[model samples]
Target: MTGPGRRRAGAAAAVTAALLAAGCAGEPTPSSTPEDNRVFTNPVIRTDAPDPQAIRVGETWYLVHTNSGGRNVPVHTSPDLVAWTAAGDALPELPAWADPGRTWAPELIQLAPDRFVLYYTVADRASGRQCLGRAVAATPLGPYRDDSTGPLVCQAELGGSIDASPYRDTDGTLWLLWKNDGNAIGVDTWLWSQRLSDDGLRLVGTPTKLLKQTEPWEGSLVEGPFFHRHDGRLHLFFAANAYDRATYAEGYAVCAGPTGPCVKAAENPILRSNEVASGPGHASMVEQDGRTWLLYHAWPPGQEGSTDPGRQVWLDEVVWSDGKPVVKGPTQGPQPRP
Candidate 1:
């Protein structure tokens, strides 16, 4: 809800106002179309793709995510969104400006085939400089780098950080959706966006506020913003509530275009777990083999801490229509549906 230009994820700030935003239009949503939307084939990739990001390269589906290991985010590829194999870590060297926290929330965009950009949050928890950085590799999986001007976006104090999802509309104007939070240190947390320079990296227009506050079911945390185009509308999917509690959820929002005053649907918590996994948030969508699937992290019923690297990856078939996504349920593994 601010002016446009230089969009930065603020650190340690307060909410500017109550986010009382709602959905728009009575026009029929295309997410309801029976042909474009199909019944999902179960459990494609089961490896932990925390805050996963994906790109469709030709007939192949490639996925990458926040570093679940000691290094950068890892990339995995598959044909049907099921039966995946690891390619490699996206980045190997720790960014010079990066802190001990390594990297968080890895996002990928296919600006063109064989030419892709991987963006992530590199935080030096000690120095407290949370930065948004980029790495470019000719292939989907590679040894990506801090190839940008160091940080595409950075906030150090209380709310300084990164996690970016880029969108380009039919008009050719590119947009970026990222998290902003840090009220403890005067930073504000919400969804923010900005126009991109022709290259798709530099900030062009001013930052626009799209979403804030959130549904009560989401508790207090809001993060992991992923967007896609469907039936002429833009849909936003994000993780919400606390990270270590059962109340965590993956919610959704929809807009007609990139620059929205976007809207959240009442039927949120699109992908949530009431079982032992505490909270299940931070998600990404992959449109593969004539269908859509969702990837995110959950406690998996037996884990207790977030530091564990083997958080079991869960898959769900997403019903994307009407500018919104609906998750049928979680798949146990790669078994043929009955």
Candidate 2:
């Protein structure tokens, strides 16, 4: 979900000003070096990095998040997940069909060593609804380009589609998962999936409706759907409830395949609001040294929708016990680096 509007340049400048102030006070400035520490705290990225999606290329990790600071897709890089530095805009230019300042939930995937595909949500001016678009880049931090005259996916009749996430199966089949913007029009919000072409440029088959909000804790909607494969089982993880409230939390379903017959866990909302953080959701998994880490955004407690330090990036471990996933956060204390 998008946070309050703020320019990216302004945010960077504010951070710089604070660091300079600390130096003037004879305090040691924080280091960006990944090896500076063995333990890390919450809000790994202490800025407005909402709806974060990350990928590891070699030893460096690259992250892209919702439009802010006047970038279509703001990109950041790190030697380790705890310390991040701004890497500039990934999609510097939006397609002809998209309206500016509304880009959100960018999902990055690598098809080859030099080929990267980004699926992102943008406002469709003609349809007056949010839609999905695709872009390509040669490197992880890209000046990715989209030359389409129209959106790649625009379910206008169902209030348009958003939150496009791509998943690759064990058999090498590519699938795209997203949430229908039904909440925008007061309709039932359903998570849908479809097959993607090998090139990652287009959808190939009919869309399948996976699941929708049914539980009370989910409130009226479910959004930000992504797939994770663990121990030969496919799990569909998603965020539910209102994005701006403390009730916004994350849940998962055990799917038989990418296109499921899926079942939500009885103990749903596995990762949720705690004393340390509020509304922790929109997560993507990264595996390092055989351990899985969830990279997500969270609102600072008592500051649910504030623009300052809005939706900072948080890292938590995901442990599997008896084949069920468990989140070990929103941890306030320092913990081992991923």
Q: Once model 1 is optimally superposed onto the true structure by TM-score, how far is the C-alpha of residue 151 displaced, in angstroms?
A: 1.2
For model 1, the local distance difference test gives: 0.60
CA lDDT of 323 in candidate 2?
97
lDDT of 2 at 246: 97
Q: What is the clash tally of candidate 1?
A: 27
| TM-score list, all predictions | 0.78, 0.92
Candidate with the greatest TM-score versus the true structure: 2
**Residue range 1-338, candidate 2, lDDT tens digits:** 52222223245335434543554212221333356477777777777778899999999999998876667788888887877777778998998888886788999999999999999999899998889999999998888999888998998888789899999898999999998888888888899999999999989979999999999999988888999999999999999988878999999999999889999999899999999999999999989999999999999889876766678889999999899999999997878888
Q: lDDT (0-100) at residue 182 of candidate 2? A: 87
lDDT of 1 by residue, 67-100 (tens): 5434467677765554456665678776666654
Q: Which stretches of candidate 1 lie over 4 Å from their true place?
A: 1-48, 124-127, 183-188, 276-278, 302-310, 320-324, 333-338
Q: Model 1 residue 172 lDDT?
A: 78
Candidate 2: clashing residue pairs, number: 2
Off by over 4 Å in 2: 2-36
